[model samples]
Target chain A: MATKKFMFLNRKAPYGTVYALESLEVVLIGAAFEQDVSLAFIGDGVYQIAKNQNTDGIGMKNFSPTYKALGDYEVTKLYVEKESLEARGLTLDDLMDLTWEDEDDDYAEKPSIRLVSAAELAAVFDEQDVVLSF
Target chain B: MKYSIMVNEGPYTHQASDTALHFCKAALEAGHEIFRVFFYHDGVNNGTRFTVPPQDDRNIQQEWSKLASAHDIDLVVCIAAAQRRGIMDADEAKRQGIDGNNIAPGFRISGLGQLIEGGIIADRQLVFGD
Candidate 1:
């Protein structure tokens, strides 16, 4: 089958619900297929990748570190809605640094998180062949 | 068109499973091909065979099982999600050092990759959850 753009939409707060974690599981598993995979953090989903996540109090595994490993899986393109972040009182600085290595460009590291406005994200959504929401 | 359906919530607690079943029935009746129905998150709960719902209400898991058998549909429960939710098959049960399995007939535990594969193969992919 041809490579289709599978964009996963994360719209919930991490740890509060299992959507963010389960969606990441899909993204990690999707890497082996080598398809064009991308993830969007909209609304409260922006907190999913917020740095300094400590789950010691919650008794749940802190899966926040997994987001960093997504780069190794070749599953880049983490889009954070600018409006969503601001609405949540967060900024790009609040998120973890997620980057992928470019093997052809002397293995240069490039940022994977793209901060897009809701308007710009609409275009991104239109380009997706499949949009899986969580 | 070949279609893939995804259910992201459990039965009774949410309407996603019901909506997905309805969509599948309607799609099949309209003569569209259902490539697969993927259960993820709480949706994996739809594959458990241990449910004992009130007699009057519908048995969502059994309904999915019956629909899959009659239509040769593939019902896949995401293994990771299933494992997390204690929805195990015989193999998984044994692997996890458990005594028995609760997977409904016509359903199998598989990787999330199956969901992505369906997206690639299906002409249309419908998601039935928040």
Candidate 2:
């Protein structure tokens, strides 16, 4: 099977609708297929991986932990737009420290999340064979 | 080139469906193969036959049905989204003890795997949404 580069473009905020959750579901499934999967966080999507997300007030399940588990699924290429984070008044410290262990290098743990500017992220889009936005 | 379209919104409510339809038509005219058109989120509503639009307006459901029949394209409605919105085929309707099924012709309810398969099979997987 030919492996294709699948990029999930998340621009929606969590809990407004089912888009964020459903988009994550697809990502998890796609991870199992062992494809070259990357997730881009843009606009309100930056809030999805933000730290200390408390959904108790809204009575919704907090799925922020799943973002951390992406490493286990071998989905480590997480690109966060710098403009999006700054626009939302957030920094790298505001989000979870997502990382994956590099098995090739004796299981050395490495950071998974990479912050990129809007232009850089747009270039990432150009490299994708499949771009599924939510 | 092989193409796969993902519609993230429903008809009338958003222009995503309309845009996807136009893209599909143009792609077909250009002699491209559409692996599938996967309907997700509110897009699953496009498969429901219960929508009665105004006579003067173009019926989106019929348009999709006709296009699918004309091109033999796979019009798949995500089963998870469909079940949540009560859009089911005959078998699903019977299994759920529903009185009737509203799944339009040329559309089948399937798992999210179909969408992944489309991404894998198609040269480009285009997403049309808000």
Candidate 3:
């Protein structure tokens, strides 16, 4: 069977609605199928991977940490749009730490976040077998 | 190439319809055949024929009517979802003791089998959800 690559573009705020959580679940299921998976954060979706997320105030379970575990599912390609991150004053340091593969060691040691342009990310979607946006 | 589309947002309310329209147009341009367009959840509202927008604006119902009619696309709205939202066809209106059917032509109310069939038959099943 040919390998199927899946791209997930998350576009909702983290706390207001269930779209972010539900989208994470779908990605996990897709990972279980062993499909090649990657994620793109756009709009308010940048919050999904934002650091220092405290859901305790809402009496909700903190799920941001679950994102760090995505690497175990072979879903390590988490691409954040450079403009969105900069607009929110969020550097890679403002996100959870996971083993991110980077070309340079200095940046890799700090927070190995890979940033791509929105146009570049749009082209990435076309390359995938299935592109899901939430 | 044949494609199936799953629409989850209601009409004129969200970007789901707009994205679905874009995807459909792109697929057609790429020489693809659309096998079906399945409406689920709030999406069932798109099948209603009773919609009337401001006269100056582009009518959502009319836009979809033209697309489906011109392409001969199979627009299937989930029956269960439709009933919950009070969107009825002639048969459903009779059974529910409602006044009359308000759903437009070029759209059909059907079971989830349509979804499964589309998923199984089409080369791809593009989903437009909230």
Candidate 4:
């Protein structure tokens, strides 16, 4: 089968509901399917990958670490909307430093998180075969 | 073109279901093939036959059932989401010791794999949600 471009759009915050977690679950599964998968963190969805997400008091499982595992799943394209991060008074440094190894370059590490403008991301959406939002 | 639709919200509570229904109608009218309509999250409520809207209002559940029957479209309600929201098929209801199943005609309870399969097979996969 031809590989399709699949984008998982996340617009909700973590711990509020099951959207973020379930969205991640789908991404992990989509990885096994070996499609050209990309994850977009828009709006409060950026909070999902924010650093130091301590859920001890909230009594919820902290699945933030799973985002770091995206590299292993070959889901390397993680787009963080520039406007969304700025609107929330956050910088790229606040989020996890996710990376993937480039086998073509002798296993050289490459940054997976791409800080993109809204317009640029809109263009990216146009190039996708499937946009699964959560 | 083959199109797949995913509804993430329930009827009457959100406009997602309504938008998806209208979109499906438009797609069908345009001579497009509807590969599947996968209801997830609260969208599973759209497959339940127990929804009784006021006579003066639109019956969303009935509308979907009629559309599915007329077009011979596959209306799949995600089994995991349906189970979480108390929407079950006859077999599931019996297995879980529930009183009865509320799955509507022309609708079936299935897994998330159906959603993934739809995305793979269809030319487009449109998601309607909050």
Candidate 5:
């Protein structure tokens, strides 16, 4: 099968409804089908990646931690909007797992997830075979 | 190329619907035919006929109606989503004894098969959601 590029846009706050979780599942399925997958996080969607999220208070399982495993699914083209991060006072350090961040401060090492402007990310939407947002 | 577009976000609740509307317009402008636009999840709200916003502002529901009417767009609302949200058609409203129907004109209740079919027929299926 030909490689199909899939772009995912996440725009909701994590854990409110099942939208964010369902979006993640679709991206994983795309990856499983050997598609090239990229993710764009914007607005309240940034909350989906906040580190050390505690869901116990709401009696919900902590799903935020599962995001760190995206790389294992071969879904590495992560792009977080700079505006969303700055609006929430979230640095890249707050998104990646503490262990991963600790191991990769050096530029010689593997760079962390990429951050792109909203316009830059939107420019690539036309190229994708599919675009999923949730 | 035929296209399938899924909208999972509610209009007036977020920017997702606005973005999706713009994209739909652009898709048409680019000369790509859209096979269908599927409203699922919270997106079912976009088909509500009873929304009355401030008189000073533009009404989103009316705007959606105009878009569909003017372009002859196939506006489909997922049956499951609409039923769950209490957005019922004239038939369902009668059975449930509702005084008013919530389904707006220019939109129809549809099954998930419409979405799947869109994917099969369209060159691309893009989703805009929560």
Candidate 6:
């Protein structure tokens, strides 16, 4: 099949629901098909990649580390809405440093997180052929 | 145009499944082709054969089965999600060394790849969920 622009819209928080983790599973499996895959974090979804997430007391497996491996699968584009982060009293420093290696550029690591405004994210969403929400 | 559907919630609890069913019926009635209906998360429960709703109420699983039978639609349940929720077919149940299977007709357990493919193969894909 021909590759299409696929975006997974994450609008929910982490562990309280299964959407965050299951959304990641679809992204990983979708990567093997080599589509133009991107992930957008909006609303409470921005909390999914919050750094230093310790789930020991919650008794749930911490899957935040899986976001780091997304780059390896060539699922590079990750857009986070700036307004959402600011609304939740968070800054870029609060998120994990997710980056991708540019194989052609001497394997230099480049940031994958593109913090955008609501308007900018709307344009991104308009370009997708498919968008699945979690 | 060809379309694909993703259902993220199960029967009765959330309206996602019912909404998807109505949309599918409407789409088919309008002469559009439905490439597939991929059920995931709690939506896998829609494919269980053991669900027995009140007779007066709509039988969610049976409705999907009848739709699939009439339209030849592909109803796919994610295997990983099904295993987590115990929605199994005979093959899956036997493979897992279990005694019984509860998958409804017109549905088959597959992989997340099928979900991705549904999006890729169809002209448009719709997701019904929270």
TM-score leader: 6
Could you give the TM-score of chain B for each candidate, in order? 0.98, 0.98, 0.93, 0.98, 0.91, 0.99
- Model 2: how far residue A69 lies from native, Å: 1.7
Model 1 CAPRI rating: high
True contacts kept of 5: 0.26
Best by lDDT: 6
lDDT (10s digit) by residue, model 3, range A92-124:
787777554444555353332468898988788
Interface RMSD of each: 1.1, 1.0, 5.5, 1.3, 4.4, 0.7
- Which regions of candidate 5 fall more than 4 Å away from where they truly are? A98-112, B9-121, B124-130
Docking model 4 quality class: medium
Error of 5 at A48 (Å): 0.9
The CA lDDT at A129 in model 5 is 67
Give the worst 10-residue stretch by lDDT in candidate 1 chain B.
Answer: B111-120
- Each prediction's DockQ against the real complex: 0.83, 0.72, 0.12, 0.51, 0.17, 0.89
Expressed as tens digits, the lDDT of each residue in B16-114 for candidate 4 is 999999999998899999999999888999999999999999999999999999999999998888888999899999999999999999999998878
Q: What shift in Å separates residue A60 of candidate 2 from its native position after superposition?
A: 2.2
In model 4, chain B matches the true chain B with a TM-score of 0.98
Chain A TM-score vs. truth, each candidate:
0.96, 0.97, 0.86, 0.98, 0.84, 0.98
What does DockQ come to for candidate 6? 0.89
Q: Predicted candidate 3: what Cα RMSD to the true structure?
A: 7.6
Pick by lDDT: 4 or 5, better one: 4
Query: How many clashes does each candidate structure show, in the order listed?
Result: 0, 0, 0, 0, 0, 0
- Of candidate 3 chain A, the 10-residue stretch with the lowest lDDT total is A103-112
Best by DockQ: 6
How high is each candidate's TM-score? 0.95, 0.95, 0.58, 0.90, 0.57, 0.99
Summarize candidate 6's per-residue lDDT along A1-134 as a digit string, tens digits: 79999999999999899999999999998899999999999999999999999999999999999999999999889999999999999999999999999999999999999999999999999999999899
Residue A96, candidate 5: Cα error in Å is 2.2
Tens digits of per-residue lDDT for model 5, B97-124? 8877889999898776565456545788
Q: Write the per-residue lDDT of candidate 1 for residues A11-121, one digit (tens) a residue.
A: 999997888888887887677788899999998888999999999998999988889888898887999999999988888898899999988899899999999999999
Where does model 6 exceed 4 Å of error? Answer: none
